[model samples]
Target: MSQTTIALTYDNLVNRIVPGPQSLSYFVPLVVLPIAFSIPPWIASKQTLCAVALPIISASLVHAWTVMGGIDVISFDMLLHSYHLLLFNDPRRHFRRILAKTATAEKTRTPKVGSRDGKDESTTPQYIEQPYPAKWSGRLPWIGTLLISMRFVDWKIGSPSHDSKQPDRNPTAPSHLRFILTAILRTLSGYVVLDLTSAWTQQDPYFKTFGVSVDSPLPQYALSGLLPPRLIRCTIMALQVWASVGQQFQLPCTLPVALHWMGYLPDAWSPHLWPTFFGSFRATFTTPNLGAVRNFWGRYWHQTLRYYCSGSGVWLANLMRLPRRSQSRYLLISATTFFFSGIVHIGLVPPEPIFALKSANQIRWLILVFFWLQPVGFAFETAVSVVLHHIGTPRLIYTILNILWFTAWCCFVLPFLGEAGRNLGYWRVWPVPVSLWQGITLGKWLAWV
Candidate 1:
């Protein structure tokens, strides 16, 4: 050890994360306050509204981040809105722009008011007002607007709907019964995935082990001079991270839709508004190719953060006067997006002595490096795939080779993520309310027997 003594403890780290009970109050307002204020500007129907609204929103967001701890999900979410607001500067893009009134066939445009002489006295545009807004239809009260504006991830125009194959060009709104059923199923699936992963994690010695310093041995990751063990450990680490992140994003994402069903919020608030939210994360397995890695990040992953993460890069690229859709611009956006992702996640790392980290900066460095390497890997994967195709590799053999290469790539880089995650106490939190796996393993199930 480098004789640099850092004064920190495990309990200090744990204390920094606000407990679940205390977090709800902070969480609600962190999400709601911004949307509440945003509605007026949204109603004003001015894109410039975000200009005035964003600074205030950004201040509150920064204040919340400073005060809060361990509520990464919504915290990152609010920041995305702030970035979108700052960069896009369009209130309509941030929130769904609904009509003041629902339009019937007659009220689709301006309506004519006739005097007793049957001549039009006044003709003013009228929109239909509805109890519930349809999928493609518009018209909602201010309250309905508030509900719709609160959403962070699903894009009004580009987002995929209930059927991933179908874009929003012809949207289909599921029936209330079907929508609720889907929400319930998704909620249950998320819970089971989380609970199972938590149970396995609690049993895994990887989470139990920690090093005294960054240089100290971390047996969980096979820090010793060993290859096979390191590969095994890294592979397991990747799977655990994948499962944990999937459920974490899935659980919170389903809540708004479920509430929509319960509160009878609005048809505009229905799954038709965001079908992808119901299944935001797609299955990871795909035919191994250049698109495999791209698809994993772009399609299979939960894209809640994609909008603002990429938007920050887009803003920067534009500021640099890069040509639109140029290779350099694409690379810059990709790098910036991953870099922002790293910055967002770095918030999870507390002061040192949390885990193996000697100083918080050590973990921070690892976090940034881990994310920064992603674009490098993506570019390399694309180049290699092209070379393989040019060399006349058989499709089946090429795919198999790509799978191995990707798995090996994951094994190489995922240890950085595993290390950062551990230092941040990621594996410590058990999000599930009740522990069925604990009950089973501990024989608490005997009571039911």
Candidate 2:
């Protein structure tokens, strides 16, 4: 009879059980803030009002969440270590050993203590550093080691590197004076231009319908007051632009693995850069209200359509009205892509509410389905075009349908689903006008939160 045997060595165990760099990299993007708010004025000009503003705000919020989450993780690790020590009756140790080894290595690499002129003093005895006392050692458990490994991977993949020996300083700010002056000028210019344009444009009949009275000086002054806040906002915006540019443009110095994994492969990634450039351009030139409906449709729905139907040949076949013999193959491919897209949406949900409630999964599914169905519906309508099509849908009927849809979904269906559904759309949690009013009335409460 053959006997089963198990053999384990320290290195083999470590390799098998210990977390690696890749684990860290995967977590970093989830925790670290993306280069938001850093869009240059030229790029910001390309985005619609909502797109331009929302991303920057969201980035800052994510950064805050990451910082808080890190603190909580650290505190919990400490608690776990304390619990382990109490339960096992084996006082946690081994941190000093690691530190002593690290210290010894550093000493060998560089001159230590009082060694003058970069020369070793042969007169004095060299002492081997001892590990920290067993009782006081802050050794992390195996799980903590894995957590640290994952954090390291994330930092390695996503963190931008700078020369550690060099003093870190803001490259954008030459001095405190320059920073203040720049902020003031940007605020003033943005405000003056906005006010002047509002005054000129308000003379149109459209302004009256929109409740914007150009003749009222009080309203104009109130609007102009929003400019100063932009100065503070610009600092964050500048940082975002710098980070994005560094990440996208300065690929030579970035980690080779990250570039390879992202499919950069020499120059294939340059095409990806065009989106940022085009988005910037679009944000700048596109007027909000003139052809507003068409602009919004193109910017939002068209991109959604293109994104969903990008890989599969079904969209093209459908467009050309071609009937292929392999209907099953097309259906299978479409279904798989749709399912993958749903998974991608779920994956994109921010980490805070990773559970059932507040999960981004539902929104992702809705958005994906909307993109797929909207185009198909439109195509059907186009195929069945009629002479009276221009006036086919009444404005009041459309307005009622929109109200009914919002009420059925946002106010009713979502809350009934689960905690996730209720918390999912934070953006729509409060009416914008009401929120602003509350902010004005309860300034401290608004600021605290």
Candidate 3:
């Protein structure tokens, strides 16, 4: 065979032998669900899906509450756009691929000192020398480990080569801009539809509550109350945008930075302006009790679905129509996706005081619960697999593990934390009514409403 053909064959062989870096990077996070399942029965008894689901469900309810209160549709648009941007902009993948290539190069460059140089440097028997520098240990720093692991995976998976011979091309513009614009337009349209639908649906209730005629404009009492609704809606949208952005980028993964920003933003603005902006935006979106609930649901559904669909490679591949065979592949992929979801949740963590508030406290608790549950849950799964003969229900097992893990954490772990429990509240409030709006949108439009 020609040199080129031989090289190509070798490359293909190497690619087939090595797993993708993206896949390997996911291993750390994906183990969380299995860890949850591995918990002891006594601990498992304390876990209930409702504990995990309720806070999330409540948060969704509050998001709708704010929307119904009257936040501008644009605010929601901006928030979603930010999230999409962060999701696609992760640089870790590229960084890993680079490291992997460098390693491969270094390995190939090992020196045969005596033979190559035409000098006998050593009289002793020839032995393979270590490729790494003597001054440096083979052990990598934690961060270095992550980067190197990522690179190894990338190279093995046939990532594009970065050799100098490959001429650089002008980088392509991000497709995210188009997605952002589309999301904005879609969100705006949905907002309009929501308003119109609410108007018609709310006619009877408005008449009954305010003792006013349905054919005419809102009565004075209702008009007076409208401003608060609008303000609440804007607040919800802003929070959703902020939370979603943080989650997508894994910004909150740096806990200290996230806390600083959360505390800083609210304090930086003029108190009056903050409330006014929030109120006006909320009014624009049309917030009220029920409307707020609907908006909360909408944002919840949006975040949850987005996290599940795109946050992990496995889920993204499946959602985007990539093929997978065998139950193990599916389990592996789902675990990876779930791990990413946890990272997103970590990004959403709030400061101590903010977490102490009732709603935020619940979310904070949920986050902590999941954090501890990840490893323990996986260990539990390994133990169970040893005894169980069937492995046909990996997905079901994962789900059960999550449910049990959260339940145990909430009941046994949380109560012991004392004041730590106080840290469970939300920094932002979303009204419960948004859930209704979300349901209507999904049922009728077959899309996130």
Candidate 4:
């Protein structure tokens, strides 16, 4: 294989920078968000708070999409952070309500010791302070709850169903030293995986199709032949994009946990807060054969954005006055959530490449269609499963069929997503300081940025 020459330039280095220009000014609203929401409800009505905060959130998102230039994922982060601020409206009310419910459930489940029939008969609020002390009066508790609300993905305040599996939110958090050590290992592993994937992706000409104009025909690369070599190449491209994005998502989950361990971040976070952000995709692969798609997105995928993304759907449903648990309501919520998710993901598309391309609209639509189809795919799986079951299909046959269907579906949609990502310079930039893959492939071990 011929090696692609590595070129270093100031422009390339700027693209790799963590924060874009004027990032500090961009973050001023984010830093102020918690404080704004933390103001005592008695002092300021929720309406007042929303009036004060919504415009800033809107402006931040506008700024991120239009102006933010460095590291593409920052735009995605800014959008999610905005969702978080909106969803959690008031941190004190939100966290207090959740903690109270948790305590109530714990009391109901365990009961006070010696209470008959699992009943807590005490006049006292039993198990109310299980996670932390009730008498722990200080600014620390308030600070912790606010920080936790910021990171909490499970028990999303505004979500419709609230049935998504809640991974342990407040695990026995590790110490600062342990957090740092674990973060180091996690970071190094992620860096290595990304570097190796980048090296592999560098060899694929399919990924190099960056400037296809609207007037020009879309290249039929994947469809050129349905042979094993081409098929494998497309599959590898999908996996490469998958692993790269997963590493980017997983790497950030470590930071909040580390800060929590350092006592800089107060407790009250999500399962993603645990160092175990990476899980085997097969862990959620069992049962309801049609659930492969759902399991892939809901279970195995990093859900850092789910709470806020799904919350938008819930908000829309409430606006329409849909009855909770109704089928139409569920479908509406799911569709809206998926639609919003697609729009937010446009942030991942680097504007630089799109601007250069004559067919920027094509890339935008590809991203939108990819995300908007998620709910449709889930619905289709369900519909097909029902039909197959009605025909008395054997369980084993159905399972095989389900897996094949999912594989074929992936083969159909992943290329569009993968190509958009590649065009946006997803795997092109080298992230790690040193590269073993580069040494093997490019004959050098140093990264340009």
Which prediction has the highest TM-score against the true structure?
4
Best prediction by lDDT = 4
lDDT of 4 at 130: 23
- Would you list the rank order by lDDT, best first? 4, 1, 3, 2
TM-score of each: 0.63, 0.25, 0.23, 0.69
Instruction: Name the regions of candidate 4 deviating beyond 4 angstroms.
Output: 1-25, 60-91, 97-200, 209-230, 247-279, 321-326, 354-361, 427-449
How many clashes (backbone N, Cα, C below 3 Å) per candidate? 4, 18, 75, 0
**lDDT tens per residue, model 4, 284-307:** 445555667767777677665666
lDDT over C-alpha atoms for residue 100 of model 2: 11
Q: What local lDDT score does residue 62 receive in model 4, on the 0 to 100 scale?
A: 62
lDDT values for all models:
0.54, 0.30, 0.32, 0.57
TM-score result, candidate 3: 0.23
The residue-by-residue lDDT of candidate 1 on 308-421, one tens digit each, is: 677777777778999875878878888978988887776666443333444666877887788889888778876877787788766577556656666777767777776766
